[model samples]
Target: MDTTMSADTVVLLTGGTSGIGRVAAERLAATGATVVAVGRDRERGRAVAEEATAESAGTVAFRRVDLADRSAVRDLAAAVDDEYGRLDALVHNAGLASATRRETADGVESTFAVNHLAPYLLTHDLIGALADTPGARVVVTASSVHRRGSLDFDDLGFSSGYDALDAYARSKLANVAFTLELAERLRASDRADGVVANCVHPGFVPSTGLYRDVSRRAKLLTRLAGLVPGVGTSAAKAARRLVEVTAAPEYGERTGLYVGGDGPEEPSEAARDPETRDRLWRVSADLVGVDPDWP
Candidate 1:
């Protein structure tokens, strides 16, 4: 994955301070793009920025943000829009997994709030900025596990029961649905010159910290799986997959692709349904207090 971004390009990447995201941030920065790495840990975020800047000799700025807070997501978008004026790429790589059922400050499920709604609201706020830049792309980090998931608009919070793996998969399913829907809407928009939106299943990355919040049994399984020669995707490999989707020519030429282990592949049947996509868009908009009709 020796992909490169053009000089002066600006990319806003969520979850950029750690794990696969951190490596992706460095890789993007190495391409000469101003990579804005958003995360919750200020110290860790700043450290990554400093180290990546030193290693890549490129800019890697850090922004502390709690994606579960709707207000914070809004503020982050506003700040990025004001500072950059135009965004070349927006990557929704931040995700959440909780061992127990938890609600965010916005009264939404933690996993759903961070994994899905944050991207939904942030994209709503930044769509104008994205539209400002011709050829801008939106790449989301989804998972293949979404095939095992189902969405119940009435029960997005999983009020009936809670399982860490199940919740994560559900949120990932939303990621795919949102990416596909956004791409379609962008196509019809008059301003949709070259903006593309796609999601990639980064494969089963057992080595990433994404599963640290899962239950003991799940964590143990991930650890054991990581021991396999090639069962679990390394953070660096996963980052490469992310960068390919973000800056690759093929991805820019197309829209609404779901790339998994074998490059572009069909997502779950539920995710490809137009009705499901529309409903997810509307419900997500309602959840985040935004109008469903968007660019």
Candidate 2:
């Protein structure tokens, strides 16, 4: 990667135990940025950081965090603030794709809590540091599956009829909407002048552990898709794009854009709904116990 940040640039990435987050962490570290990876598995997290640190001229570390627990997530955010004192980027990449419905420690659905609320709390807490970084960026890893989503705030937990794929899609859709609204607020408040908050669909990359719970039938389908040349991209390639977008000056001062494999794409109808996005921001603030002010 040609892009290089200052030696002091601090990047905090979740879900770096594997997949795109792992690759992105390593790539950023090689570029001379401090990388702090967050995940629940101590062994895997340590291994990832060690490999990155070995390949990097910068510092690489790991912090165990389970985003499903609200209080735990809050504490992790506080720890990050205390340790780093400044955050240049936060990549919300950790997530779970469960075939069964699960609840978080805070009684919220696991998918919702991990995929959305976790980043919400973490980013909310780290806004001060992000704002301090002149060219800070927030990149959310959403998916094309989000196109198949519908927002039913009344049934946010999917109580009546819950399917794992649908729930995951809804969470991703919420990500795009959250990015849009958050970008708007950031620009309006002028807190993040050169900080651009954007979302991206990292196209299908097989063997990412996201399909760990998929049935045999799903696995077969994934294999078949991989057989096709352009159907699935590699984790490394996708992470390269992510790193580029996050570090590029072209994205500076721009916010709320939904980028795809082929560059920016039009977001889903639900994702573009300002009212719904605003409402989600408010609801997420309440869930995370943050004040109403979000920028």
Best prediction by lDDT: 1
| All candidates: TM-score | 0.97, 0.96
Clashing pairs in 1: none
Tell how far residue 219 is off in model 1, in angstroms: 0.7
lDDT of 2 at 131: 88
Query: Which pairs of residues clash in candidate 2, taking residues 3 or more apart in a chain or in different chains?
Result: none
Backbone clashes under 3 angstroms, per model: 0, 0
Candidate 1, 12-102: lDDT as tens digits:
9999978889999999988878999999998889998998888885699999999999999999999999998999899999997899999
Output the TM-score of candidate 2.
Answer: 0.96
Off by over 4 Å in 2: none
Question: Which candidate number maximizes TM-score?
Answer: 1
Residue 107 CA displacement from its true place in model 1, Å: 0.7
**Candidate 1: 10-residue stretch with minimal lDDT:** 1-10
